[model samples]
Target: MSNNTVVLRLARSDDLAQLSKIEQTCFSNDRLSKRSLKHWLSAKHALFLVATSSDAIVGYGLVWCLKGTRLARLYSLAVLPAYRGQGIAQVLLSELEQLTQSKGRAYLRLEVSALNHAAISLYKSLGYQVFGAYSDYYGDGSEALRMQKRVARYDGKGIRLQVPWYKQTTEFTCGPAALLMAMYSLDTKVALKQVDELAIWREATTIFMTSGHGGCHPVGLALSAIKRGFTAQVFLTQLSALFLDGVRSEEKKQVMCTVHDEFITQAHKLGCVLYEKPLELDQLYKLLKAGGRVLMLISTYRLDGKKAPHWVCVTAIDEHCVYVHDPDLDASQQAIDCQHVPIGLMEFSKMATFGKNRLRAAIAIEKLP
Candidate 1:
């Protein structure tokens, strides 16, 4: 195979040593460990492609498919010093983008060293745009520039909101955190404080869930926003007590029902419009276009199989994807992964429901002029 043309192929376990060698040769620091390379070769949501001239591997590119989102991340890419002028890096990267799009991803993202002018030039030449940056992102204390290229085209009108992210202080405060992000996007004077999170949770809690802190109900959440003097609207598929099947305790169920009923009554009194229908992304895009902030409820089951309700602020929406600011940041996820997340349009529609009852909920809020 050493005398043949440089062919591109999927990486295998046997290519581990060559891949590690390329990584070491191409990068002075921040090299991928053999263990990690081995893992990606078989990872369910990852793609590792290699370029080989005959037998020896000349270059490689790896991407991680962000599950439940229309996003794939180019984790690493490199070529041997001898192969630098052969355009192997570009070939590998282009193939990575095509593969990523074939997997239904709308965007392909990557982080490169801020000082890597050659790599940056290549990325720009390939239509990748700089979106953000990170300081001291590498082991050698070098900064990194975050870039992403839209791979799949969108059909719906895309709208992205300028929203500040606030991670939930506690597990049960995702609703409050999401709400605060939306509120602050509309009004800069609004504060993202722990006290505010707890207060909103107190006002919006369903009172009980399958276990620990109960999730927030759309009615209660809308009411919370109304209390804060923002105009609010709610969309839901059902109006009954939610998460009832999760808990078997009749007392807990009743407590949740009581809270739910109270919220509904207050929402009605406060003139919150309750739409007995599903809130589609097209509708969300229009709201975003009109400068309305949205907080949406989704099941964590689709995200991590937790089967719990989670709140995320809708930052933007298009026909192909729903951009969101997730308040529930796991240890495995970086801040970039949680901010302005792009959940695929169809994937989001499925994930926007919760429990056996398949409850769908969304709340739109706007500053009163």
Candidate 2:
């Protein structure tokens, strides 16, 4: 194919011999063998991409899609020496990622020999970072640096959408500001005026602490805030039909059970931790009783029929109070002290509904480095 028309496509069984030839030529002793090729080409989650020039395979990359964990591993990538500067390798990688996203993989992880500057540079330019290292990882005893790219939003077409708020603000939706102070965390000059877009609410990250649901909206907003120079973790929670599916008298419990289990299972695979026990004010108060650091997610909804979504984060807990950053409340809004927040074990048990076992809450924590 012409350089302008270099087609990157999935490697097929018929192309195995050609791929093996390229591998052998590129990695003499370390090349993947025929047996390995058989396994990789046949595996369902295995991603195999080839860069073709005039219909001849010139480069290839392999990745593994681990859906339950939202992780994709780049096992090996190689390009022929003659095609080194033609950008065939880049084409292969882009197509491989497109394939990865198609399979619902979230993070793209890979190990590269520490000194392999070329490969490292390629990954870095593609937004990968060194997350860890594997000591003496290679058979030859060379250490491998583990690099990762949060791939939750990658599509062959690039980011799904450049959030309007993100374009207006220079920050991401998740960060010290989104977590610690909410929109008040942002500089006033850059914060967008409160507006409604397609039923989605918009406010300064600080405004999130103002109400329980404020925090829920900020999760996506937080992502927008820090879109530049950083990759933020995205945690989506929607209390749509799923949350209130069984509240109506005529609803079927069996359908709700099946849906709930599937949803929880998918969430856990996406790095979310499910809290089976309902969250009561006192239970949360107990967790914050010692003035210790606690990361908590709180939500409230109507038990009878109407279900409105609300969520908040517990930043600190002390003997007398639980300190929270409520985005719904403005920054000047007083810190909600647990004692006066109108939470009693009895009332909390009712409002939270965790005791009734009708609704579920979960949190996904992504530690920043």
Candidate 3:
């Protein structure tokens, strides 16, 4: 079959079986079942396009339009083996890109297995750039490369900052990873590696936050940044010791208290500024516009439905959404990965609180100007 003979159009309900077959034939793991294909076909803001040759399905591409943001996710793209090298995949991709662009989206992002050189080459040829990587993302232990391409144009009026993003190697190190993003944004000379990540975690961790070796407190993170020669300011909604609510044992409570007190003393000695108020979205916008980076504490429940306190860097802010560089990567769900993730302002506010204390913590770090 020639490329000119293939016809590309929106997938219909009748094409679900063929789409499922193509998915199974192209991918060994993470293949969408027939039921899943049906769901995607019926989902709101979903675009599933199929390429047909001789009135038979040869390839298909699926993309999702993110709510309240001008972004689209290319969920899957696959072409049958018999139809390889005829530009069928490229045609499907071009059609999908046009479809997404017509919908007013500015970017189209996707993930491909690192081993899929052909697919990666095709995406690169079509102007996609690899922005990040996920370790052991597939069910078969294969890593995935995250790539994106801009499908629409913008004037770039809002504060859109770009920072080096790193995912935490361990679940307890989100604080360190987020802080590293902030520090790196201010000082591009700073290297981001696992050694420095763990080292910073050791210096800042409060030994327990709800569970498991604790998380970093705002004061400790501020002190760590200041010690590294960056100006740091801590913002908190409450003046009390942090991470004290989840510790049931008196020994653990006392240990947390000791760590918190030590951080407070270090902050005072190091001249780190502390503000006794929650960092509002407007305040964060102003700070980013003024060329400062912020590390914020938020609940993971909003991103991946996990009820744990996490940290992310505020990289950009505009009228529609707040962009962040999340340190933890949820491979199963591409939306939560550490990249230019856009969260609605209202959703961000709900995700910024944690525990009964409704702890809202943020730290702004910047170079001394």
Candidate 4:
């Protein structure tokens, strides 16, 4: 090998000093501290690599791969000023993409400073597309552009519903957005609008869950679907007051109980099917096969490391994966990231629970034939 040949290797504790120096020289702000660098050097969730030329650390790339998810993130990639003209950045990025695929991840996501035109050009040249942006995202108050690239091809023979992606307009309206998606998938005549979303939220909210506006209760969601002229069934593990654990104030708890009770009563009066049982994967697959659309409550911890109850539309399923249309789209996520998200069968189950009680709830909807 030539003396200047750039060699890439896993970052190690021994290279901490040189890596720190390089980081400080490359980035004026938002530089990782030595402690963080040391932590990531050994963090299993992070893949840290260093590029060396003439046995000197010249550049580095980082990949944050969360366990049990088909996603990886390019945390950072920086090359020394002297090595700017060389293809070292491209080489490091390509290797990172390959490693992402090796870890069974389909997408490699990243956030880059919006002002960095050269870096943005490099990413675009390497097949990355800008999907979304975050305002005031950096230490210097610079905006960040979110980009993602498909690193691995999904080989599943997918069985998916023709559902259009509709992002929730608010932070707490995922349930309504999901319900609308399911309804639209079953009947294309259904309109997706914020007015209807808020309307459903008013009917389906649990009054007060946590400190926010409120979360959608399963019973309320099922009842909301039924009221819309769609045949609906709720598969739930518990028949008691839902989302109560997320509330603390006694007055809020009482209001939630009253709302849930009314919803349960309405479901009974309307002859809604309430299957009080765990939603088995096979059973869910059969429902999908029968052309039933699903609105499932899931914990967002696996998807974004935020432990909160979130609703998503189950648009499709296959032998190896279950695809969902997530209604909650943060600035970091585009419609591509939220639409037809392929979660592995096992990973889907793990993400389908919420709270310490591990509450599992799903609403199935079908068109009246």
Highest lDDT model number: 1
Who wins the TM-score comparison? Answer: 1
Supply the global lDDT for candidate 2. 0.49
The TM-score of candidate 4 is 0.71
**Model 1 over residues 12-72: C-alpha lDDT tens digits?**
8999998888888888888889998888899999988989986778988899888888878
Task: Assess candidate 3 and give its TM-score to the true structure.
Answer: 0.73
Q: Return the TM-score for each candidate structure.
A: 0.93, 0.45, 0.73, 0.71
Better by TM-score, candidate 3 or 2 = 3
Q: Which runs in model 3 stand beyond 4 Å of their true positions?
A: 1-17, 20-59, 64-72, 78-107, 111-156, 333-336
lDDT (Cα atoms) of all candidates against the true structure: 0.86, 0.49, 0.84, 0.85
lDDT, candidate 1, equals 0.86
Candidate 2 vs. true structure, TM-score: 0.45
Summing lDDT over every window of 10 consecutive residues in candidate 3, give the lowest-scoring window: 329-338
- Tens digits of per-residue lDDT, candidate 2, 1-369, equal 235757777789999889889878987445688888878898877888788878898888899764222347787899889889877777777777767767755456778888789889998998889856767767778888877775556232211111111111112222233233223222233333323211123332222232232222323333333332122233223332233332443334344444445544444454333333544444544433422222233343421233443344444332323333333432322122110121223333344333233453423232233
- 1-369 per-residue lDDT for model 3 (tens digits): 236889888899999888888988998899888888999988878999889988899999899886544678999899999999998888888888888988867678999999989889999999999977889999989999989897765434478887887888888889889988888878887768899888888999888766677888889888888878899989998867887777798888888888888888888898999899999988998999889999889887755567788888888887756778878775545643347776667778888898888999999998875
TM-score of 1: 0.93
